[model samples]
Target: MNWQRYYKFFNYLNIAEADYFATPEKATQAISTYNRALRMLKNNKDQTEAIKLIQTIADDYPMFPEPSHIYGIHLAEQGEYKEALEYLKRVSLLDITDEMANMLQEQFVVIERELKAERSSARTQTQKTKETPQNKKASLGSVLQKAPKHHNKESLSKSEINAINKKLGNEDPSDLSEEIARENRVSDRRFLISVFVVAVLVISIFYFVIRPAVVNRLDGGQTVNQLQWLENEITDRAKDDPEINKLLNDYLSEFSDESDK
Candidate 1:
């Protein structure tokens, strides 16, 4: 829907301007346009136009409930009630599936029987135009009355304030001022707890793990150095004779094996 895109842009404009209601009137207009187009296309019987609009709407908004509902409505008028029922089943118009869709199915049944009755009673049933739109309010007036007031509270009605207050749990206006403060307090507490956990983990690793491992490596290195010094002393003493040199080699080999273990 072009109206849908325009409505999204309206939201962006409100956010960008920081007005929050920058395009409130325009947004209402867009919604009215979208709804009007949906209703018109639902009733319009021109098949080519109907097909093109329905396809466009469905292509643009596959997830919406209206496009498929209208397709079913058109199919129903064209005597494809079963297929119509399939598509109509997807929508919740007037809670149609509960009692609404059945209204359509019942109508179809009555029409089918009426066609039989027409054959028997030939000129019996009378049809006439029906009045709709009971208790209708002016569109502009309704929009103005129902739209939220982002303006000052002095301009807000008791009903408007009450509606707004319900969403905020009937709290004082002063509490509304502190809404962001509440969120900040929660975030600060959560951040502090997370920092404390991380610091504890780091400190535990340094004290219980890294420090002990460093001490063990230093002790093992000293033992290796002492073993090497003992081997050098034995070698110097054995350098005077060949037999002693062979014995010294075998003894040092045994010491090397023991040190490695």
Candidate 2:
């Protein structure tokens, strides 16, 4: 914050005389040095090094509020009110002069008001976001958009509302028609497959066990005693076969019919 803007003595000096003031060691000499360097910097159309050099002096002499105060005023002019307030506040604390103190205090009041207005505006925005339903819907829509494609589209679309419905174990009737019908079709196919497997098992059993016995009996390879022996064996093992009970019942009915004939 180089507060000292114009130097009457250095104004008329050439570039060579200005260089003599630019490099100085002490605080008083540094101020003169800064003013000369600043002019030289402006003449050369380069202010970057000038600002850095001024900043270094301000940092080196924290008690000297001149640099900070000037920098604060410069920042304030550039619309950096908060940063300006910081440097101006430093000047208020350190500089005991009534004019400088009063000036910094005035700037402080203005900057403080601006900061408070900014904070209030931010709080109002936050409160409106909390109260608005549209914002909430927008946020939920964003979440649904990110969801995987395999997930039910209808479920994601109504996710916010469905969350409450899910807790009560309530289902949407509109969804049941398609979903239930599809489930029923799958279940019917599974049932038919199970019946086919059972039929294969039954045929295998009949071919391996019942057919051999029946063939032997028909060929007269087994006498009446041997046929009876086979029948007794089947009867004894009937409980082990799922189809045996029904088969025995049918066989008994046929035998009775033949005897009647």
Question: Pick by lDDT: which candidate is best?
Answer: 2
On a 0 to 100 scale, what is the lDDT of residue 126 in model 1? 25
In Å, residue 32's CA in model 2 sits off its true spot by 7.0
Please provide, for model 1 over 1-261, each residue's C-alpha lDDT reduced to its tens digit, 9 standing for 90 to 100: 021211111111122332132255544443344454554444543546645566455444434444555555556666565666666555544332344455445545644564566566543322111212322435667888999987655777666776888887885566466687998999999999999999999999999999999989999999989978987876887788787789888986887799899
Most TM-score-accurate candidate: 2
CA lDDT for candidate 1: 0.57
Per-residue CA lDDT of model 2 for 64-137, tens digit only, reads 55556656665765667788787777667763467666667666777788788888999999999888888789
**After TM-score superposition, what is the CA distance of residue 128 in candidate 1 from its true location, in Å?**
29
Model 1, backbone clash pairs (residues 3+ apart or across chains), number: 1
Model 2 error, position 210 (Å): 3.4
RMSD of each: 32.2, 18.8
Evaluated at residue 127, the lDDT of candidate 1 is: 19
Worst 10 residues of 2 by lDDT: 3-12
